[model samples]
Target: MKILFVNTHYFLPQSRGGMANTLDQLCRGLADRGHTPGVLCAFLGSRDMFGLATRARIKVAAMATGIGAAHDAALSYPVWRAWHPVDVLPALAGREQPDIIVAMGGKVVQVIDAARQTGIPLLTQVHDVEFDWHGGDFAHIADVPVVANSQFTADAYRTAFGVDAQVIYPFMPLDQYRTDTHRRVVTFVNPLLRKGFRLGVEIAALCPELPFHFVGAIPDVDETGRELDRGMLALPNLTVEPFRGDMRDVYAQTRVLLAPSQWNEAYGRVINEAQVSGIPVLASTRGGIPEAAQDGGILLPADAPAERWATALRRMWNDETLYADLCAKAVHSASRPQLQAETQLDQHECALEAAINDHRAAHLSGCQLPA
Candidate 1:
């Protein structure tokens, strides 16, 4: 089957976030299965970042809109209506002639009319809870099916828009992450407040004896317009590392992974990555962290004090038997049937096929779709 991904943002070979990474993996998986896959995205100069080898694997059709950084805001319905990809979509779709159209992220509704006009089955992939602001207006479009990344997100959609979405966990290439390297340091990625940066700093400050690595670029200022905390930097044991595309290097040196997110995370991909590496995670019980962690890691309340985080870190570092037991559980949990790439891909394929059949039936029966 030929599938076309209508992405609002650039879908690069090595994307930073879960949504982009999942799309890249899905496209590659489809291509490997002898199916043709292409992407229609907003031009964001991401193509220049792709190396010669990565650019050759997938075909991309980027819409050229002269508006610079405003393109990112185009996911908003008002912004999208004024600067939508409607003009370019038909032409691109005509050339690719995809069997099914998968619109990713909150900008799915932007290409709904074009997909409808082309008479192609459209499936919206919802990644987060803020879809109401993104593309919730046309979510009730009868022929379009929605696929949520997790049960938490699926429930949110059901409650907010009465959309019973199919839950398909995001795909992570487990084979590539599997390793025999010994773990050593505790690690944290993307040190933003919502991701528990402050808490991580406190944990690092309290456990000054153990080495802690904070990966990813740090923002100059936080949400409150205050200078970013430099306390973590002051600690002799803490090392700040830049964002890395390939996480194997990060996991290689990580004894425990910290995901102390304060906000309700839709899905914590890092938790899965760490678990697959046989590294136990110490994360807050925010949204899907429990689900992501499964039985692989320890979870504290989202509002857990700095002392609690510090105590957990100290125990993991000092208690060799406990650490080994958690490591064994982490490996076992990651090896669960649901976490497999094949299972995820199979569910995705089934959802797409069912969407095509359902859309065709609705069209043939002349059923009036709900607005």
Candidate 2:
């Protein structure tokens, strides 16, 4: 089926975060399976394109859909509505004539209206706790189906909105993330406060001998590589790197993966991404880390002190036996049957087909689906 996926966040080649990478894999996987999948995103947004860096991002969005679909924020809106994305998704949908619309984030209400206006099947994807800013407003879009990134995310929405979302882990092409070189750096995928950046920094500082790599996942890294430029880190052991479209570049040098998440993550895709390369993860127990880490890695409290993280890092660095065990477990966990790329793609196809059929049935009966 021809499916049009909508996400407000940056798609691949814009942001190399785990979500973006996996979504790219998802689209590519679908395309490989004889399905045409396109994506619509805010793409550096409609407002504040004045900076040279912002304009560069706009240019980089050339392959917006990554599947040869037209993508551009609507430009007809007044200046006051600049904060909002250019709202032309419905018109785009009308022209693309997709059998299904799977909207991810940003102004999802707009996506809902687009689906309703275009009379297309809509499936909203919940990637995390903050899937929608207007979470309570889900009652309005009760008829729509949901595809969650993990069971934790699905359960959260289920408890809050009485929505039974189908859980489909994001697809990660493990082979793409594998690397030959394993550097000594302990890597953190995205270094932000919410992602436990403070803890990661503290741990690095505490362990003077251990080197840490902080990979920025932001679109432009605020143009000047914000994390590295600050010069705030007294310890020279930590290196802040800019976002990379190809994570193998980062993983190639990464010995251990760190996810000191302060916020409750929906599903830590990066752990599995790193694990596929036989890299063990040391993460927090805030949300889906346990689920994602499974038997592969170590988990500390989100509020664990810097000393605890440093100790863990030191042990992982010094103890070959423990490290080897965790590394083997990481590989085994990543190689699980359900975690395979083909499996993920199959799940996505099945979910989309089911959602599409449900919408068609509802429309044929001339009835709004029961919540």
lDDT of each: 0.74, 0.74
TM-score of each: 0.84, 0.84
Off by over 4 Å in 2: 45-86, 131-136, 217-229, 367-371
lDDT of 2 at 304: 79
How well is each residue in 34-123 modelled by candidate 1, as lDDT tens digits?
Answer: 777666664433345333322322222132433221212212111111124445666556655789988877466666766777877788
Clashing pairs in 1: none
Q: Output the lDDT of residue 229, model 1.
A: 62
Question: What is candidate 2's CA lDDT for residue 145?
Answer: 86
Lowest lDDT sum, 10 consecutive residues, model 2, at 74-83
Which runs in model 1 stand beyond 4 Å of their true positions? 13-15, 45-87, 132-139, 225-232, 367-371
* Model 1 residue 101 distance off true place after TM-score fit, in angstroms: 1.3
